[model samples]
Target: MTDISTETRSVVIEREFPFPSEKIWRALTQPHLIQEWLMKSDFKPAVDHRFSFNADWGSVDCKVLEVEPNKTLSYSWDAYGLESIVTWTLTPTGTGTHLRM
Candidate 1:
C-alpha cells in the first residue's frame, strides 16, 4: 500500500508605495515598463493570456490567471521544474497604495 498527502502554504509580501494604484498597475502590466523593474516579458493584463519572461540566464513560462485593473492580478509562474502562482493585490490608502504579493 502507498499513501500520499498534499500540503499548501502561502507567503505574502507587503509594501506601501507612495504612488497611486494606477501607476503601480502600469508597472505590473505593461511589458516595456516591467522590463525596467522586473524582467523582459510580453505580459498583458488579461485573463488566460499566455506570456513569457526572457533573460540571459533562462526564461519563465507564464499565463495570466486573473486581472482587475488597478486592483488585483494573478498569474502562473513556471520556472525550472517548479510551478507556482503569483498574485498581486493593491488597496487604496490615505497615503498612496498598499501592495500585497
Candidate 2:
C-alpha cells in the first residue's frame, strides 16, 4: 500500500510595534502596502476568499481562513510541495500594538 501523509507544525513570531493597530492593519490588508513589504498579491481580508501572491521567482496559492479588523488574519499558503497556515494577530498594548505572525 502506498502511504500518503503530511506533517504540520506551528510557527509563531511576535514583535512589539510602536504603531497603532489601525495603521498596521492597513498595511496588512491593503494590497499596495503589502506589495511594498511582502509581495504582489490579490489578498483581501475576507474569510474564504481566494488570492494569489506573485513574485519574480514564482507564486503561491492561498485562501483566507479568518479575518478580524485590526486584530487577526489567517490563511493557507501552498507552494513547492509544502503547505502551511500563517496567522497574524494584533493586540492593543500599553505602548502600541503587539504583532504576532
TM-scores of the candidates in the order shown: 0.92, 0.91
For candidate 2, write residues 1-101 as lDDT tens digits.
98887665677899999999999999999999999999999998899999999999999999999998999999999999798899999999999999999
For candidate 1, list the clashing residue pairs, or say none. Answer: none
Error of 1 at 50 (Å): 0.6
lDDT of 1 by residue, 1-101 (tens): 87754566789999999999999999999999999998999998989999999999999999999998999999999999778899999998999999999
Candidate 1 lands at a TM-score of 0.92
**Model 1 residue 39 lDDT score:** 92
Instruction: Please give the CA lDDT of all the candidate structures.
Output: 0.94, 0.93
Worst 10 residues of 2 by lDDT: 3-12
Off by over 4 Å in 2: 1-5
